[model samples]
Target: MEKKKINVAISGLNNVDSPGPGIPVIRALRESKLYDVTIIGLSYDSYEPGLYMEGMTDITYQIPFPSAGQEALLNRLSYIQQHYPIQVLIPNFDAELFNFIKLADRLKKEMGIHTFLPTVEQFEERHKANLPEWGRKYNIAVPRSQMIHSVYEIANLHHSYTYPLVIKGKYYEAGIAYNHDQAVGHFNKISAKWGLPIIVQEFLKGTEVNVTAIGDGKGNMIGAVPMRKQVITDKGKAWAGITLEDSTLLDFAAHLFKETHWKGPCELEMIRTAEGKLYIIELNPRFPAWVYLAVGAGQNHPEAIVSMALGETVTPFTTYESGKMFIRYSWDLICDLKSFEVISTRGELKL
Candidate 1:
């Protein structure tokens, strides 16, 4: 049987030490049984490795940074559309999601592009700065966290938080600070990268587990897969993970989607204490870099989201194989300097 052809565009191709979800998401899409995908890789930097990986992208275009605002983004997409006629766009960065979420309607109405993303209210409320209030509203247990714009707030954090607290950026990057000086150092570092209003959260002693799931605009979870990190990098990225048959974690993610009616792919970062209490540490509004694990375990969250974006109904996945493990590794791709020069200078490359 012939597959339906789709022009799908995706961003967040920076697969580095601290990777992005683009490569994994694209891999899932490539394996889709329902569609023949033409992958358009949207990138913010020329150095993003996925731009050069063989068989990864049909074409790649450099896009303006999120700081350039939605108008600039729309213009770029408009230019790309003239060439590829994008039918579905999946944006994977936390910082850029706000712009994409805001433009979802315009992209669809004007350019015939469809995106399955969270509503602006859903995006704003689940922000790290707003997680405390969001937890209370949804009855989800979240750690005590305070958003601060200045380094001076680190001193006052002692009043509410103890040592070994977690310091996180507004969009990404996080660190465990064992003392005041470390906290100051992390604040300066993360703030410089992701900008101010860093969040200081009470550190929970527990094992870190993650859930990657998708929802269909309504209060229905299409699929969810829970995984335990088997290997972690210094940057806190999961280098390896194994799928688990944990009902409590699955129930927690289901409840969250039911309450918020999340409309797209999301990753729930949770910590389970020795006594079995679970606390949500972070809620990523998009798929994680390890999302391919879900596909390997039988969930295929990216495929489900793409199906939903194309106005197809996806049946909820009830079971996935436990003990399915994914170990991430690196490879050296030998590409000539000319390939790099063309993409760097022209801001687009056709592979």
Candidate 2:
């Protein structure tokens, strides 16, 4: 049988120590039996490793950051589509999801670009600022949290929160502050990077677990896989993780999908307390760095998502092999000066 060839474009290609999901998603797609792939790496920075990594992408192009507004992004994507027809675009960054969700319809209508993403309402409801309220509405346990704009706000935090709490940026970065001084420092540093309104959540004592899953946008969870971090890096990334057998976690994820009708790939960050209670920590509206573990556990969610985006009727994945383990590693790639200069000057590299 001749396998159908599809050109799939993906973003969030910064496969650094704190990696993104692009590379891993690409790997899973490349292993697919449904289609042969022309992996298109859409990157924000010229030096994003996935753009230059061998076997990572057949072609790569630089695109504007999400904050550049939707029209600018549309123009750039239209230009890319003029040359390489992108069948599906899988954007993998938290900060960029808003723009993607907003533009999904336009892209499909104007440029034939397809994407599977959560609706704007579902996306906004999961923000750190509104999480506590959302948790209550969904009948889920969420760590008590507050959003603060000024560092001075932390001074009076002791009234509501303890000295040791978790300080989180609006889009990224989570730091544990053991004291007021640490809290102030994290607040300022994170605020500087991700802008105002850092999240201060009561530090819940528990074993952190994660679930990487995809939703069908129809109150159906397409696939869900649970994992436990066996080894973590200093940055708190899972350097090594193993798939777990946890029906409760899967049931919770299904409940979230049903309640929100969550449409697209999402990683639900969860914590299991000592008394066997589960608390939803954070909700990431895209694939996690450890998404490949889901693939290894017998569900290739990325491939399934791409299929769903391309208008294929996909059945929900109800089962998977448990006890699979994923160990992450880093390697250096040697590249020529011309390759770097081409991407830097022309904003693209094709080979």
Candidate 3:
């Protein structure tokens, strides 16, 4: 059978120590049974490893940073569309998702580009700063957290939060601080990179588990796979993980989707305590770097979302192979400097 051809554009290709979902998502799309994908890599930096990974992207275009504002991003996409004609766009970065979500309708109407993403309300409510209230509204357990915009707020945190708390930035980066000085240092460091409103969350003692799931716009869970991190990096990213047959985690994902009617991909970062109580630590609005594990396990969430974005009705995936594991490794790609030079100077490269 001839597979349907799909022209999909994806971003967040900085596959480094802390990787992004772009390459993994592209991998899933390449392996899809339903679609023959032409991967268009959207990159912010010339050094993004996915741009140079052989056979990974058919073409790569360097796009403006999210700080450049929505007009700049749309203009760039419009130009790219004139050349490559993107049918579906998947943005993988937290910082960039806001612009994508805001432009979803415009992208669909004006550019005929489809994107399956959470609504602005859904995105805003699940923010790290708003997790406490989101949890209360959904009746789910979440770690106590406080958002502070200034480093001076760290001194006052002791009255409300104890030692050994986790300090997180608004978009990315986090550090566990054990004392007042460490908390202040973390606040300063994260605030510098991601800006103010650092979140101080009560450190929960538990095993970290994550769920990579997808939801259709109308309150149906299209697919979900829960995994337990076997090995963690210094940056708290899962270096190795194994799929699990955890009903509780699956149920939690289903309930969240039903209540919020969340659209597109989401990763629920939760902790299972010694008493087996689960607490949502964070809610990433898009696919995680490790989402390829779900494809290996049986549910191809990235593919499913692409189909959904293109207006296809997909049946829910009820099961995945338990105990399937993903171990992340790095390999050096020997590429000619011409590839780098072209991308750096011309801002586009066709492999």
Candidate 4:
């Protein structure tokens, strides 16, 4: 007998204008017809853009975080469970995972809701500055980086490294500095506004490539797609990307799961230097926002994620349209309009 569709809840829908990675994941799952999907938003606002998935999901519920910390997240999850009766919870953001990790075991043990995720230790390495350490441990080339716990630390080590270094906030995005003064200037401002240690890195000039994948915890590769950023926004989401098939890069991705026992979807950023060598830049344990392209190219990563969570075997993905580019139409166009002021309010501007 065919099993009834399982209920799945996707959390962390914070905006509507530009949907996040989870949006595509949910959409893919809905298309797959493999599960009874529920869309969940964690903000108290009750109007997350992800609620747009209401058309696709079996149910839509918004459980606002009740406090300023992890407790608030747990409270919301509890509310979601009682109200929606979802059997699986897929968190889309780092903050959501941080909360889910606290009660992952409890959620599974007490409520029978499986939270598919890496171990807390693995999650820590993936989201924080510690990821480069994994690359080093596996002999993966990583750019020179120094962890800065405070802005003052930058001043002390400014002389140790050359200019064009990167100033990265521990919990925020990074910025490039062409000289010691520039590094310090950006470091001071970011630290004052964003807080904590920043990673000072030697910026590698190269093409940035991102590889997205799904792994089965036990060293088995389920799905992978290698793509390069053809165009990127200042905020770092790839506005356009060209797909490629490189087993060598896939090997590096395989190493990560082999070493960390990672399960679920992950994206690794790599920089190909002028010398043609690729260096691992960072790893995101969650779905890459651009995953929609992979799906469009015939790699259904989100469905693979669901299969893994359900203890089903998945085939390796060997399909991708090499060298094809996809531009995020809305965001890229909006960026152009805002930056160039080329698009007039009344009509499209002529160049």
Give the number of the best model, judged by lDDT: 3
Instruction: Return the TM-score for candidate 3, rounded to 2 decimals.
Output: 0.98
Alpha-carbon RMSD to native, per candidate = 1.2, 1.1, 1.0, 7.6
Give one clash count per candidate, in the order shown.
0, 0, 0, 5
| Cα lDDT of model 2 by residue, 1-351, tens digit | 777899999888899999999999999999888979998899889778888888879999999888899999999999999989999999999988899999999999999999999999989999998899999988888999989989999999999988679999998888999999999999989999989899999998999999999999988999999999999988789999998888999998999889888899999999999998889989999999889888888999999998999989888888888888988888987888899899999999985
Quote model 1's TM-score. 0.97
Tens-place lDDT per residue, model 4, 125-164, is 6544675676666666788787777656766775777777
Candidate order (lDDT): 3, 1, 2, 4
lDDT of 3 by residue, 1-351 (tens): 899998999998899989999999999999999999999999999999999998889999999999899999999999999999999999999989999999999999999999999999999999999999999998878999989987888888888888899999998889999999999888888999989888999999999899999999798999999999899999889999999998989998888888889899999999999999999999899999999999999999999999999999999999899999999998988889999999999999986
lDDT of each: 0.92, 0.91, 0.94, 0.68
Q: Which candidate model has the greater lDDT, 2 or 4?
A: 2
Judged by lDDT relative to the true structure, which candidate is superior, 1 or 4? 1
TM for every model, in the order presented, reads 0.97, 0.97, 0.98, 0.84
Off by over 4 Å in 1: none
Stretches > 4 Å off in candidate 3: none
With candidate 1 superimposed using the best TM-score fit, by how many Å does residue 138's alpha carbon deviate from the native? 0.5
- Please report how far candidate 1 places residue 333 from its true position, in Å: 1.0
